[model samples]
Target: MRFSWLLLLPLLAACNSNPSAERGEPGFGAADPESPADATALPAPDTASTKAVSAVSDTLRTVRQKHNFSNPKGPADLFKLVYRGPSILDGTGEFTITNPTGEVIFREMLTEPDLEAALVYEMKNPTATRAERETYVLRRIDRFFVPSQFHTPAIDPNAAFPTGLETLERATWDDLQHRPDAIGFDYLKGKEDRQRIAWSPLTKQVVRVQ
Candidate 1:
C-alpha cells in the first residue's frame, strides 16, 4: 500500500499544477512551452559623449548671459582668433571678432591694403546724412588701440609735431600743419586715452563721460 501511494503522489501533483482542470479557471501565469516568438534585444549604445556635450552647452549659456556680452567663446576658441596685428597693443584684431562658439560676430576687414582707408570710407558714407563725420572718425580711430608706439614713421608722435593735434598721421598733419593754434605733437606721446571725453552723439553735447 505504501509503494502504491508513492506512485499516486506524482499524478496528484501534476493535476494540481494544471489550474484550468483542477481549479474553476485557467492559470494566468501558464504559457505554451512550444510557442514561437522573436527575442527582443539590441546593441548597448554609447551615450557618454553625447551626455557630456549637452551638459557643457548648458553651462556655457548660463555663464555667457551673466555679462552683457553675448555668446562669448571658450579660451581655446578665443585663442584661435589670431590677431595677426598691426592690431592695437590692446589685442584688437584687424580681421575678425568671434564669439565663444567660433562664430565671427564682427569683422574689420572692409578692404585690403589700407585699414584706415576702409574706416574713412565707412565714416564718409554715414548711415544718416545728418550725422557728423567727425563723430564717426573719432569712434573708428579709437578702434586702433594698439599700445605700442605707432609703427609707421608718418604717424610717430615723437617726431616734431603740433600741439592739440597730438599724433601726426598724414591726414592730421595735412590739416594742422599750417594752423597757428596747433599745440604740440608731444601731447600724443603718452598712452592713448581711448576713452577720452569727447562729444557724445546720444547726449548731443560735450559730456564729461564715456
Candidate 2:
C-alpha cells in the first residue's frame, strides 16, 4: 500500500508538542508492566555485532568529513543538509545536523535516497531477513544522529515480530522506546483504523493515534 508522506508533518508536530504527557505509561518511559524482571537485561555483544557497529561508526565519520558535515556547535545552528549525488551512500541523501550534545534537533520521514538505496540493496540480499534489511537501512542513514544504543527499540516480548518491509518502515514510532522525552511517528493499522500514528517514544503511548 502506498503511504502519503505529506501526513508526516502533523504527526511530528503532535509528538514534539507534548512528549511528556504519557511519561508514566509502560513502554513510554516506564518499564513494560507485563515483562519479566530480567526482560531489559542484555548480554554482551557478540563478535559479529561488535564488528558491525564499529564499521558503521567508521563509515559515518568518513562521510561526515568528506561532505563537510560538521557537527552543530549549538542548538541555534542545527539545520538540514541535502545531498544530490552518491558521495556518502549509493544515492542522494539529506540529514539533519547534530547538536554539540549529539541530539538530533529535527525529524523527518525516511525519504532520503540513500535510505531508499539501502532498502533496495537489502531486498536483493538472499541471506537477509526482512527485519535485518530494514534495520540495515535505518542504521546506515542514522537520520536522527542518536547514540547507537537508542537507534532501535528494545525487544518487547509482547509485541509480535514485524511482518515485512512495510511494517518495519513504519516502526520508527517505537524508536527510543524507553526514554522520557522520546518522540517519533510511524504508519500503523489498527482493527478499525489505518493511518500514521505519532507517540511518545519513551512510553509508546499514542498522542495522535490516527
Candidate 3:
C-alpha cells in the first residue's frame, strides 16, 4: 500500500511539538514505591533509558523466527501500532488491528505481553516487511502501551468492556480521540493515517482533526 507524504503532517506536528517524545520515560526503571500499581507493574523496563531493552527485543524476534509465526493474512490479522502523544506523562500507546475493509479486529494497549507477542509475530513471518518491523519497534520504545487494567470503563449501559487485553480495545473512533497523542498506523505496509487528531483535556472534545 502506497501512502502520500501528506499523511505525515500530524506526525510531524507531534514530533516538532515534543522533541523528546521518542526518549521513552525518564527514570523509567527507578524504584518508586509511591507509584501506582499500574505504573510499577510494567512488563519491561522502559526502553528510553537503556540499550538492554532493545537487545531483549531483538532476542525475542530471533526466537519467533525460529518458531515461524505467520504474517497477517487480512484486515482481521492486521494490527495498527498507535502512539499517544507527549502530553501524557507515561506516553501511553496501543496495538489495534483492523480487517481489510477497515473494521477493527482487536485493540490492545501496548503492554509487555503485547509487545512480546507482536515482536515474535513480526520476526517469524518472512513476509512481514520492514515497515511492519519498524512500526512494532517504534511502539515498543515509545511507552504508549499501557496495561488495560488501569482504565475504568466509561459509563455506558449497553456494552461491557472486555476483560484482560481485550479491555484495551476501543468501541469507536471517538474513543481514539480521547487518547493523548493518538496516531493511527497501517502495520503491514507501514502507512499511517488520521494524522490530524488532538484531544483537549479541558473541553473533552476532539480539538483538532485533519
Candidate 4:
C-alpha cells in the first residue's frame, strides 16, 4: 500500500467542517465531560494548559513499555504516573515516545483525552532504515483483560491496524489534526488518493509523509 505524494491536493486543502457539520455528532474539539464517570466522557484533561499537557504526555511515555497491552492495571493507576496526582478532564491529551533503551525521545500534546483505560500507543523506532516517525494507536473494547472492572481492549475506530501501512499512517496523521490542543502541530492526509503529509509548526514543511 504505497502512497503517492504527487496526488491528494483536495484533502490537504479541504476546509475543516464546523462542529455541527456532522449534524450534532460531537466534534473532536467539543468540550469534554467534567468527570471521568460522566456518561459522555471525553478523553481530554481538566485544564488544557501547556504544563498539564506535558505532564500527560510524560506519563504516557513512562508507561508505554511498562503497561501491559494484554492487561491494564487501572485508570487511576495509569493516570497517576502521568498526572503526578489526580487526573482531571480538560479536552486535551498527549502523545509520548520512548526509545528502546527506555529513554524518552519525543512527546507532543494533543486534544485526545482519558485514553488510559482504552487506548494503547507505541512509537516506531527512530533508527529504522527509512527513519520515518510512526506511532501505533489502538482501542480496547474487550473487558476481563484487567483485574479492574474498567478492563477493555483499546480500540481505535480511526486506526487501520490490520490494514496495510498506508491506512495506518493516515490514521496517525488524522489523529494529530483531530486534536483540540494542536496549536503547533500540522497534519495533512490527502483526499481521494493514498497520500499523507505532516508538517512542523515552525518550518511549515512536510516532516512525515506516506
Which sections of candidate 4 miss by over 4 Å?
A: 1-63, 66-88, 112-207
Global lDDT of each model?
0.32, 0.39, 0.38, 0.32
Model 2 regions more than 4 Å off:
1-79, 86-91, 100-176, 185-210
Which prediction has the highest TM-score against the true structure?
Answer: 3
> What's the lDDT of the predicted structure labeled candidate 3?
0.38
Could you report the Cα RMSD, in angstroms, for every candidate shown? 19.1, 31.7, 29.3, 31.2
lDDT of 1: 0.32
Q: Estimate each model's TM-score.
A: 0.17, 0.19, 0.21, 0.20
For model 2, state the Cα shift of residue 152 in Å.
14
Candidate 3 positional error at 116, Å: 11
Off by over 4 Å in 3: 1-77, 87-89, 111-210
**Model 1: CA > 4 A from native:** 19-99, 102-210
Candidates 2 and 4 compared: the better one by lDDT is 2
After TM-score superposition, the amount by which residue 33's alpha carbon in candidate 4 deviates from its true location, in angstroms, is 52
Candidate 3 C-alpha RMSD relative to the actual structure: 29.3
